[model samples]
Structure formats: C-alpha cells, structure tokens
Target: MNINDHNPLPTYHAADNRYQEMKYRRTGKSGLMLPEISLGLWHNFGHNADFTLGRKIIRRAFDLGISHFDLANNYGPPYGSAEENFGRIFKKDLLPYRDELIISSKAGWDMWPGPYGNWGSKKYLIASCDQSLKRMGLDYVDIFYHHRPDPETPLEETMGALDQLVRQGKALYVGISQYSAEETARAYSILKEMGTPLLIHQPRYSMLDRWVEGGLLDVLEEKGIGSIAFSPLEQGLLTNKYLKGIPEDSRAAKDGRYLKPDQISGDKIQMIKKLNDIAISRGQTLAQMAIAWLLKDQRITSVLVGVSRPEQLDDNVASIKNSQFSDSEITEIKTIIGA
Candidate 1:
C-alpha cells in the first residue's frame, strides 16, 4: 500500500474491542501508562517481508490494546525500511488513531557508513532522529531513544541531544537502551539537570539473561526511570522452538547473523528442555512462562517483543493471563536455568 506523502492527520477513534482486558502499567514515575506487553518491529516488518501482512499484524496489535509500537532507524534488513513500511500503514490506517498510540523510534546503532554515521554524537543523534521522523512520516515521536551507549562519545553530549529533541518538540520523552547502571545514572542526572528527565530505560532481560538484575534495577528504582526489556524471550531460545533442534524457518536458521547455530550448544539445549519441563508442570508453555517471569518484576514497564507472524503475537499476548507464579515454581525455574 502506498502512503500519501502529504497525508493529513485523521481524526482519532479508539478501537472498540477488549481494551480493558489487557493490563496497563504506570511507566515508573512518569504520567504515561503503557500496555503490559508492547509490540516491536525489530526483526520482521521489513522491506523484505510482506508489507500487507506487516500492516495486518500492527492493526491487530492495536486492536488488542497494544498501543505502544517500537521502531529504530536500522530495524529493517536493508535499514530504514521498517519505519518506511510503518509510515505507509500509518498514513493509510493508523494515522487517525495516533492519539491512542505510543510510537517510539531509537538511534545510536550503525545505520550509515562513515564517521558521523554511528555513536551518540549530537550530530548523529539529532540527524538520525530527523531522518527517522521523515521515514516514519510523523511530526514527532512519542519517545526517542539512544539505542545504545557510546563509550567513545561523552555522556553529556549524548544526553544533551535528547534534551534538545524535547525542547524542539521533535520528541516528547527520551530513553536509553543497553546502558549499564553507571551509564544510566550519569545520563539520568544529565537529563534531569537539563530539566528533561529520562523517561525509560530499555534493557535485555529474560529468563536466560539476568544481567539487569545486577545493579540496573536498583539504579532505575532509585531514580524512578522505567525499563522496557527487549529480547525477553532470548532470541527464541527460551521457547519450545529450539527444544527438538533448530527448525528450517527458525530465526537461527533464517538469520545466522544475530543467532548462530553454534551458539545453541548441547548444554543450552539441555537447559531449555529442563526449563520446558518446569513450564509444563506449571500448566504453561515455555514462552508464556518466560514472559510471565519478566512481568514478575514491577520495575519492568513493558516487554518489547518481536513477531514474524500473527500466531506468535497471539501466543505472546496470552502470557499475561497466566502471569502469576508460585514461590516454589520460581525456585524451580531459577534452579533449572541456573539463575
């Protein structure tokens, strides 16, 4: 579908569906409230994928009360294609419901070649956001984030660009992803000093990955900055998809760049099997149990999940229904995963 280059903003109308069934949690101390499970266009929704089907997934997500949509400058396989594809759907269908949506885009990863292409420099961050807005066909994003920390660049300069984006009305709030506790605290202080507090912190927290529990959670709790975890399923390793070995259509088999075959060792598979057994005993699928485990932490504002098909979205959303975990189940899960 071709989105109008000069499309006008349409009137807002909330979708009439089971909106109240999905839980909405407060984003830390912020006034914004996000869906417990937010949809992200990280792996799929690219130019290489079916744009029509991608649009359907997005519409279905909104209809299911998943108002938050996450994107990045380099999300598409060819880079910038996901945002462009979403721009088409936005103008065609979602523009009218923009008021009911929380659209976010991030930068700070390698997008273009050359010196100013990557990092957290003011030039790169600001220009990247502008390019993202153009590709998204929107005036401003609800949240703009630095995808990762750049040790080469000063934190002051990086946080300054985020503050400037808010001042210019190009972004409502700012966030940082994949940053350590020290880095988050420094950036938080800098943004707060500039009078624009850091809104959210995106990390990779899953049943398999527990690095955030080290000190990141403590720092965020102290500062009142919300956290949204990406890859909460650990690139699908936390699910039954890899229990019998990698399938031909699995992410590892399709895209070896992010998840390689060698990465799935015998020990990892054994751990997965054990975890799956625990999930079965709990009367839930491994995917459901994994997502529910992350939601157990109240500090986690949302879990940003990727979906290649509609069924995957349905399965992930169903996780919320069985989020409660017994103390014994938690202990067994930790022992199985060695967490």
Candidate 2:
C-alpha cells in the first residue's frame, strides 16, 4: 500500500470489499452496470488543486465501490489539466485497476478559442477524443459524451463521429449530456442507425431543480437510456452549508463561476433548513439525503457526486445505505421544493 518514492510503480490495490457495499445498476439496456454512486472530476481535480489529494479521493472512492470516474476535455481551470492529472494518477495508482473502472470524458463546450475547438462537429469531436485519450493515458474510454447538443451542427454528423469512435475502438459507448427530450430522441435514432446505441444521458437533477422530471426522464425511460444525475445537490444549494447562510469558503463566496451568493437568497436558505430537518429525521445528513432521494428512482441508473476530500466522498457514498423514501416523504419533499 506504500508508494515507493524511488520507483513509484503504483502498488495500490483497492480493498477486497470494494464491491460489497454499493450495488451496481445496469446502464439503460446495456450490459454495463455502474456503481450506484459515481465520482465526477468536475471540481478539485484540476491544476489548482493538490494532485496528491485528488489521487487520494480517487483511491478511496474506488475502495468504496465508485468504479466510474467521469471527466471531460474542458474540465479544468487550464482546460485539459484534469485529464492530464488523472492520467498521472492512473499511472501512479489506477493502471492496474483499469479494467475494473468505467471512465468517461466529454467534449461539446468551447475548448479552444478557435472555430473548430467547440461544438459537435465530427472534426472537433474526433480530434478531441484523440487528445482526451492521450491526456488520460487510456486506449479507449467506456463512454464518450457529446457534452451538449449543437444547434448548428447536424445531428447525424455529430453522432456519426461518436459512431466512428466506437467503430475505431476509441470509445465503447456514446452518450449525450443536457440534450432535451426531442434532441435526445433524434440523436438516439441516428446513433442507433449508425450501429452505436445511445448508452446513457447525463442531466442535472435534484430537489432544487426539477426540469428533468418534466419530460426528459420519461424519454430516457421509454427509450431505455440510462441516466446519471449530476448536481443532485444543486451546486451545494441542497446541502446544510447554506442552511444558515453561505459560508465564507463556499463555492459561492470565492468563485461565482456556477454558484452565486444571490442564488442562496433568504427564501432558498429557509427551504434548505427545512429540508435539512427532514433529512435529520431520516437519520442522514442533508448531503446524504439529497443523494438518497435521487437513488429512490430505479430509472436513475446512478448519481454523479463530486467531492474535494475523501471525507466528503465517504459521506456521499453512505447515501446508498438508505436510498428508499416513503410515499409521504416524497409528497412532502415535492411540496417543499415548490413542485
């Protein structure tokens, strides 16, 4: 378990009981079964963060049955730095467990400042896949997602690139993130025709945000497309950290990139406190309850939870201990979230 400072060949072997606690769910109709809770590298895996800490989170998560590690080409402060750091960690710790892992990378947002650096064009996607593979030091990722739908790029061309990747052995499964029900249907049809079944859909789902409940989740269920809910805590809004008010070190105080202080207004704070009370009644932290709420739905294949520290990861993983909710609790939660 100790790292040889001289050679550093990554002698880390995950715990034998890694798969004992968490249950794996089948992705849509595919044979792949992801852990109930997956780890996403959207934060704290960048260059600004300590590489050692990031590596520790990955190792501990693996030991806790988090076999899926989600990443993207544009996921770091300096763009592809997260993938590069993950590649380094792969060499230092996870290379041996590669087969046991389900790693995914996305490309659809603006990566570079040029024209071809963004969107769903085949050119950009193909090149970005190659770059991501190089940065992650992997031969093929389990899933490669078109980060978002492009209004301009033809769906055929965009999905065709993913088809090519699968055929070329660069990516095993293809998915779409943030695609609406209509767009997802079209994309799925095209990929299906191209011989690559759309594996899953990544969407932001939580108590605070119920957009997925409108029609997207239904689309996924009807089409047998698996779903992994991201931001299930609503960027920390659903956690106890903002129940009283935003902390000085919260993501809102320092960085307003995605979360803003104003979003945690008086009304929102009150709601969060009420939700926390409900969570406490369930014998769980608000964070754990938030995740458990998502897992209550069998259609939701997994929940992508991101953490900065190993303790945070431990808390998130404990959510699986109580993933069920009574019908009365669900009704109360819906009323509380203003549904």
Top-lDDT structure, candidate number: 2
State the lDDT of candidate 1 residue by residue for 1-339, as single tens digits: 232234343443446984866888888799999998999999667777777677767877887789999999998877998899899888878887888889999999999999998989999999999999999899999999999999899899999999999999999999999999999999999999999989999999998889999999999999999999998888989899899888897768977676777768888899999989988987888998899899989999899899977678788888888888889988888888787
- In order, what is each prediction's RMSD in angstroms? 3.2, 2.7
* Residue 32 alpha-carbon offset, candidate 2, angstroms: 0.6
Model 1 misplaced regions, further than 4 Å: 1-15
Judge candidate 1 against the unseen true structure and give its global Cα lDDT, from 0 to 1. 0.88
Ten-residue stretch with the least lDDT total in model 1:
1-10
lDDT of 2 by residue, 1-339 (tens): 121223333568889999999889999999999999999999888877877788788989999999999999999867998898899898889998889999999999999888999999999999999999999999999999999989998899999999999999999999999999999889889988888999999998997887888898899989899999999999988788888787887778888686886798998888888889999999999999999998998989999999988999889989999999989988988888888
Go through the candidates in order and give each one's C-alpha lDDT: 0.88, 0.91
Give the TM-scores of the predictions, in the order they appear: 0.94, 0.96
Model 1 C-alpha RMSD vs. true structure (Å) is: 3.2
lDDT of 2: 0.91
